[model samples]
Target: MSEAVTHSVPSASTSPGLLASLDPLLREWLPRQRWFAGKGRPVTGFSLVSATEVLPLNSGLGLLHLLVRAHQPLVPTQSAPAYPADCYQLLLGVRETLPPRLAPALIGHPTQGPLAGLTVYEALHDPRPADVLLEALRERAHLGELRFERDMAQEIRSDLVPRLVTAEQSNSSLVYGDTFILKLLRRIVPGINPDLELPLALARAGCARVPAPAGWILADLPADSLGPGQGDPGDPYVLGVLQPFLQGASDGWDLALREMAKGEDFSGAARALGRATAEVHTALARALPEVTMGRAQMEVLAEGMTERLTAAVQTVPSLLPYAPGLRSAFDALADLAGEGQTWTAQRIHGDLHLGQCLRSPSGSWSLIDFEGEPSKPLAERRLPQPTARDVAGMLRSFDYAAHSLRAEGTQVSAVSGWADACRAAYCSGYAEAGGRDPRTDPVLLRAYETDKAIYEVVYEARHRPDWLPVPMAAVRRLALPEPS
Candidate 1:
């Protein structure tokens, strides 16, 4: 079973198209994937963008590099507009038979065509092919438009073995002997990927709160906005990014839980984390362009929040009682905008929460996953947003941690007091770190928190039904009448 399969390379001279044979397999497998965004909908069709063989087709093994477009129609609902087609990268390993070690990586068996009677599996799951991919990047190899480039200043050891990080969902990560990690993005959109763009900018600005890019993979595709009527055309889309792995780092969420279990005060750590966050924001603002939103634009932002709240109540009926209160928060924001208020906006972590951060053993915090809200368009994710949004997200995370303890029958008063102290210290640290105090602007912060809670309600209800109470409680708090 370990023997390599020998088959004619599918090229221009081949009879059946290589992509045509794999079409059915992809359509069947894509929707079943957890990383696939179109979970509730069926995949209607596919459009092959590119099919480049990383190695020669008839080499020791068959490795096909493919970028395919999956078409999924909107679910039958008036509020539901058609979701745009998404492009995904597939590194397919075709073998005559899979070894026991690779048995878990099986995609499916192709019954006919060029891949007839062969086992095709996701290559990243197999160390052999995964090493081959890393070698290609290390050697700066080029196959057609796909290029692998690395920072020459940073050393890349080819000897480091590749092992897949199994817990990832939206993307795949492989650690090379604990020295470096490569994050291969699954769903892709053309243009600059913020996951790569933001970190590079911050790293150059001397920001120590983010992992610097050691290497990356990119593909040049036809230029197009991926709109309804626009044809296929776009610039290079970042396929993956590599960075030095943080050794002995713990997930922020896990750290918080540990502290709660020990009954230890976490205000000190929370304050330091807040300072780190502000420093990164400062670096980003210095590196990127900053903008100011006028009253008109603020109103537009309020409308967007209202729309989200409206949709959320339809699914999470528990939100019905708090809808009016949440709507008032958005209204207050709009009223301020009408009074000729303006706010500064800049590049931020976009989606900031405890789970998205990592705390190292050295007592320092690093922010990861710069990719903004997954449901948003790529263009919107790149837009400058109010920094208050990030602050609000962290504040909500504090509440989530406390409520999780309460759900476990912990004393509500004790956990609530602890959360309140941490939240206040975090805000104080942000102000001391040369950032604006979130408390100074209650309207914007409250609105952002409401918007975030509304989103959480829908997400928790769908994914973790038991956790729905955590966000539902926030909705009620945010909806409460202000102190007169």
Candidate 2:
């Protein structure tokens, strides 16, 4: 759909040494790459260790996968969530190996000729890698073989191969043509992912905001140190899962932003979004835990976000601003968290935001991206917390949409009006479904919004510093009472 063509590097390594010829490729590729979030910065190291053929030997031309491993460990020195050391594991996809006559010009490519010098092939033209990976997944396990525990359901499609669709730091998404979006977990941890879980539960409860699962992928990872009370013999980590890839969906984050950028009234849509939120939470309450607004859980969340902020800052020094006040803010907020007028605990969208939601073709909204913060460990993500956490996430997303588009050269006109409409629509919708009153909880909402804004400001600073102004704007807008 996007006019941007995909340029893939070889999957396996090309040679033991770092290929000097690839220096130009690496430099040019990194900045334009969607997967590598650290684009603006220079790469510290780029090397081609060796090559491995994933498919059968004579699989086809351009299938020579050179696992190009590059590392650039630079911490941000900013006043927000510090950046962390992130590794770029590129699966280079070359289309065709050139003739011996043109080998000199294309040798640096190993398989295909240079983009500008000679004729070449783009591996995406064939789409075999996505195919091989899917075949490996399906026959690897049967429908009823293993307990489908990761909160996802599965169904096989006989039509197409899995294509790599999305790339974030911790996960890579593979979409098999139209059938499914298989999220391959990177930097995995022991046990199931919460994103995979909450959606499945919502689906089971007949909630409509989620993209229902067809099935999922799990792995029996090595667990040398078994926890004292953990179950399962060898199923240590959840590798990934499969969900219906919305073939024609607009990013809710974008929709919200475009509205804000145009300054259109989004209050109606905002109410609808709110209604959907309440419905999902209600469904979650019915499906997961007995709603208990308790202190123990709040404390756990406080500790977790605090540590995440610290880690994010250490990795990217650009986010150093919020670090100094993170702990004290958490400590102060933790008290207000459990002592709310009335707290209701339920299974929540670990990572809820506009990006996590999709606008269906019919103008209906559906949430995706179940994985909470991609950086958080799996075990911590599975913990239950306030639904307000999810609420804060979506609100922050509204801010993100507005800011991201302003960066896209879109004119800023009635942007704030659209944002207001979205809020109205979402809130009205959410309140109707949850039996809550938006008018009655201004202070409570303000506090949660502030809490979330601080986190968002730090998060944006780390990932999209250009977009940091979105959350910063939110921080300026919120009416948080100073600690007495």
Candidate 3:
């Protein structure tokens, strides 16, 4: 737990009419953001959940923190279910006129709000406001409902330079002098986020495969705002996380692609990554409680997978043909459970893929990002799941890397062989490190892989139609009988 101290608060300036005046501008700007989730749906309106004046606008440089709810029309399909309004976190910089250097961060000048006639841009893009956020974390400042806390054991410098990372999809990241990277979650959910919780737990367990959380920001919300039975009063939402940035580390996805393009073997790196993943899993098991999943739990899991497949087929008609074969994989796992087979369930990385890994210059591998599937509910993402789920996700990632660079309608035998070799090597490494081979449980592994493939199919169909064929190929393979 981090120590917190109250800081001098700014005068309240965010009134109910503030969001109403900014509504028109936000509706246009919010959808254009890369981190915005509701891309297809039109933003109907905005509701201000909470707003704080981080710095007074009387100064030339002002910072305002906002938590606003975006209302959109529900697009319910068999595959995609209806969801409630989404809350977003915004850090806005106020200036009388925009500077040429900060033109790209411009969110447009609001003509109707308290901030009318002032240019409001992304604060993270500016070094001054970004530094303010880091300083708050270093000081453990509690400004109103927003609290910035840091690991007492870790020392944070006051003079690191801040630069906003541009490639992020769901969240915004600011790298501070290659020493620390702060991930500010764009979507706001009122609960303990696994991204912060798991990393802190791994650090406590002395897991070197994951970066330790040096500091974090949280927002306290009313219990009633969280809805009934969601959480107790005073459960703070994880707003951002600060972690040590591994200098000279390469993304696993980029590394794999480079190796594949050169026709060089990536099995050794893949094997090392598998070992690192197993180490993280081992540490997570040690830090968190484990449970034995019984027949009832197995049935529930299988049923959920089946339902997802049903929905996917409804939305992506291409999946209709392979539905039966995919459903069989889930059925096999349920059958094994019916026969009294059980597996240990613990907190595993919910969304494990090559993109979530980093390879240091020294050739050591480290896993990053434990946020799980961003589309899932916070409670579900925090649930204990079978380790095979993560293994399946990585396995699919290997396959994706193999096909990612291939041309359309090209023969897949060579790339498929490469993916197969990497997969086998990874599983072998995991067995050597974790003492359990994922391949030993064929039924369970196949079920998880199939479920992951189904999820890929749905995601690709919705987001990247061109990439749909990649997961569709896996769906075709998983739907077939396993080699005897």
Candidate 4:
């Protein structure tokens, strides 16, 4: 979390209007927020897309729902390649005075706007607003274009207390009485959100490897005739999704770390997880469209990998030394394509890692977080890719676990043996579970793994400098002996 700093509250607007006090407050507060995508970039301007008072604004306590476009230009000039705008959802709670408990959630006090002298803060930080949001969904209430909906067959109790899930990074999740979990997407994008679409499809396919979807909240925006597929019903942007909360479940990342701490072998658990992953892949293949990409497509895929590597090298100069060898891995893929190699492309968990999975008390794995890479464009993430990409993600995760321990001042060589054992066991289990063994295609697997490592290099450099060695070590191994 960023250190708390005092900020000058925005001056209030002269007009007496709803949301009149928000512009200045958000300008100062949004950049400091963890969920804000444009953290390092300057927020040049803001445009209010929509604002509705879910709870009467005039009331002493207020709940205002806002959709604001944050305009962040790469260069503060008109000649730049169009301004990049990200629409964000803001749920604001207004009170006459800040309570002792809610002090941490304060955005700031507006001195001149409509909310002048009132304490304004993030509503999700308070249970009252969380409960209000859930109850509205239970009752299927509609406030303008924002629709709060739920599955009629699933009964939701209004009295169920809501508690925010704190471990999340990209999105916010709230658990209600341990029965249901609602995930609110802070960054809003137009079109179908795969997080919602994939789960619905998996449930319909009768896949038990995923938690059942209970309900969802969405925003139906006015049609943009200029947009592609303007008449499509999926024009509505998904705001949040509700699903059953796993009561006795532990995240796979934590489970692996715990096993490592005990010096116990995780091969058995890794094998089971591999099988579960295959099951979900098979179910997704049955539920969605599948296509075969020939040599030409494989070349395109290889080129994309090379492009990402080149981009990462520019950002993380440490990658410069290994760029050639990394490019050779991609070149290997292209060479295979030249030999007429073909692969299957289908809907996959674009971003799959240990943390994205959960292990139930029964020892079964449940996949979650189907939103894909939050930084990637939605259309690109939606495109079908090799299932091996998901396998590579998990494979890299094992390596990450090993390196994480080393970073924690517990340097040991034993983690390598454990990770290798888990990787082999996982591949064997995947083969047994009716999926092709990733090890069988070493070139493809290596290429994908290399790509994933390069991505991690850039990510670690930007986020955790201390963690850069984790991926840098992988980069060194990927590079060859270099004419020894």
lDDT of each: 0.83, 0.57, 0.88, 0.82
TM-score of each: 0.93, 0.67, 0.96, 0.91
Per-residue lDDT for 298-363 in model 1, tens only? 999999999989988898888998899999999999999999999999999899989888989989
Whole-model lDDT, model 1:
0.83
Candidate 4 residue 396 Cα shift, in angstroms, is 0.5
For candidate 3, what is the lDDT? 0.88
Clashes of each: 6, 68, 0, 3
Please give, for residues 1-484, the per-residue lDDT of candidate 3 as tens digits: 4566786666645565678767887999999999888888889988777788888876889988998889888776542322367889999999999999999899888787578889989899999999999999998998877998889888899989999999999999999999999999998788889999999999999999999999999988886453345566777789999999999999999999878777788899988988998999999999999999989999999999999898888889989989999999999999999999999999999999999999999999999999988877788899999999999999999998887767354444456588999999999999989999899999999999999999888888878998888898899999998787
Which portions of model 4 show Cα errors greater than 4 Å?
1-20, 75-83, 224-234, 411-413, 481-484
Clashing pairs in 1: 222-233, 222-234, 223-233, 223-234, 224-233, 224-234
Q: Enumerate residue pairs that collide in model 4.
A: 12-112, 12-113, 13-113
lDDT computed for candidate 2? 0.57
Point out the worst 10-residue segment of candidate 3 by lDDT.
75-84
